[model samples]
Target: MIRHQRQNYDWGINAEGSSLEGGAAQVAMNGDTVFIHYICRDEDGNMVDDSAESEDHPVSFEVGAGEITGNPLFQAFDEAIRGLPLGSTTVLEARGGDWNRELFFEVPRDHAEIQRLEGRYKNQGGLQDGLIVELSNGGSAMVVAVTDDVVKIDANNMLAGKRRIFEVTLLNIEPAQR
Candidate 1:
């Protein structure tokens, strides 16, 4: 693969200079704050996540750190984002990684609720269509499947099996203090 070159760097969200792009990327630096709007999608072109959810949802991050991009689509993003101007828009195709597939439990569950909900859902349809199960305690689980009398619900950070596409624009960047 061809090695891409470093481009421009900017200081803060309030740049007085005109927009920056490809060849003009020398203005961008690792420590410079970057303001961007972006959308992330799966290889099949389905929307995964996007900054467009709200006016304040655009992404902001230091140029080189790995915080905002722990997903498998990092390389494609790094390449596609190269030399993008402040207001420019870009789309990145990302495949889900293990980190995106692992389920996380926010609240502990006793075996009783698990058994009850599973048994109630057994041989039931509409599980995969999506069902929200309200726990006796606060919070809910999105039911994904029911089989062998087992209700297979996964609460993971990553949306499973779906391709995600993202539309992004640079919003703001603040380099962290050393």
Candidate 2:
């Protein structure tokens, strides 16, 4: 079962760019697919990610599917969206742990992805310390240090160990197909 808290949205006000607001609609339930756009920030109010700027906008996920087990963000989102009205903009909160084996890990400097980043910025004085490089896998990592033989990279989710605030707009919801 999913556990969560709730602070429902105000009535009659539309979520940004949402055309479904104020219309009769069913609430999202488990086994339903939800379309959403969200902006997440940490305790310090630093923007973590804005789905609007992502290549894949209006992302969809199934509530309670837990396809990626042990992901707290996913769990929190499942908690937030379940039973939420369509076309509502809700604030979802979660406290992240400092460590997650799947998210926090290091890779060799010579790793293909790192090398690719190095190649991209080669003419620009090469890779530098503290440069956050975008990975081909759609993830990002910070360059801890670059040494003669090895580079240190920290690919931890930025939300780890911090209070998270997700302003999630529920654009639409539909029954999960299959």
Cα-based lDDT for every prediction: 0.49, 0.70
Predicted model with the maximum lDDT: 2
Off by over 4 Å in 2: 1-25, 99-142, 147-157, 176-178
Cα lDDT tens digits for candidate 2, 57-123? 9989888875456665566666667778776666766654465666544567778876888898788
> Candidate 1 lDDT, tens digit per residue, 1-178?
2232332222101111234333543323455556666655566666556666866755555565433565434434443444455555555433343433345332223357776665666667434537777655655667666454555555643434444555556554453454
TM-score against native, each model? 0.46, 0.57
lDDT of 1: 0.49
User: Which number leads on TM-score?
Assistant: 2
Residue 158, candidate 2: how far off, in angstroms?
3.7
